[model samples]
Target: MTDMVEAPSGSGWKLLAPVRRAEGWLASVPAALPLLALRLALAVPFYKSGLTKWDGFLQLSGGAQFLFGQEFKLHVFGAQYPYPFPTAAAYGAGTAEIVLPVLLVLGLGTRFAALALLIMTAVIQITVPEGWANFHLPWAAMALTLAVYGGGALSLDRLIGLGREKM
Candidate 1:
């Protein structure tokens, strides 16, 4: 048997290879910028909201219990939740929001943080349908984008070259 190997004959493939690479690179640029902006914008509110919960953990927890409690008559989607349980959920939600935002900002554990925030956003949307119209879509979109694209160029994960390994 004779071994056969084919060599490039300087066809159109070679000519278009660079162009394809350039196009691919360009496509990534748009995605990267918006992702960075979204992360930064979302980070501030998320961090602040989380901090507020941490600052008033007791009151917030109580408030959750009160809001979700059966006695409150506040059914999210025709379902009544136990007061104290809602409170616990609120506390957990707040803590996740606060912690994940920081991690997102730092570009550390980006995928994990993004996923956590995504879940938090979903829970909030469900628990408070009224607020869903205003904040749910945007927050959910941002979290999803971050989950997909990860922390941008300015992230600690990228700076340290650890993004790929962790992600």
Candidate 2:
């Protein structure tokens, strides 16, 4: 057989040489960009929600109080109990919403942060099934991306070379 081979035509393997080149070029893109995008996309919602969780930026109780008392039906504890005490769950969720997003943005503990947000996303879905299509589902999808793919090359985890791990 000859050492040279000809590219086949009409089967789409020959005509798309430029497209193939573009694909090859795309392969060099750093993982950091997508990971950073995931972080930002995931961060804004939680930050806004966290901001809403408090009536005031300075006070920690206002918004969470209203949510636990009226809006959210966390049902974490037995609903039958004299005190449903959604407050505890609310506190956990709120704290996580605020803290996790920041951590994610900084890529500080990307996998761990993604994990916490993933759990919170689950809780949010279970707590408010009505908002599934509106918010929870989309949030969960992004959180899942972060969880499975991890912080990517742009994250602090990557910067610090955390756990000597690869994303």
Clash totals, every prediction:
2, 1
lDDT of each: 0.69, 0.75
lDDT of 1 by residue, 9-126 (tens): 6786568667867877776675446667877877887887766554464456444445445433333658855445656666676777677888887888776788888887776665
Pairs in steric clash, model 2: 32-154
Name every residue pair that clashes in candidate 1: 65-83, 69-83
Model 1 misplacement above 4 A: 1-31, 56-77, 165-167
lDDT computed for candidate 1: 0.69
What is the TM-score of each predicted model, taking all chains together?
A: 0.65, 0.77
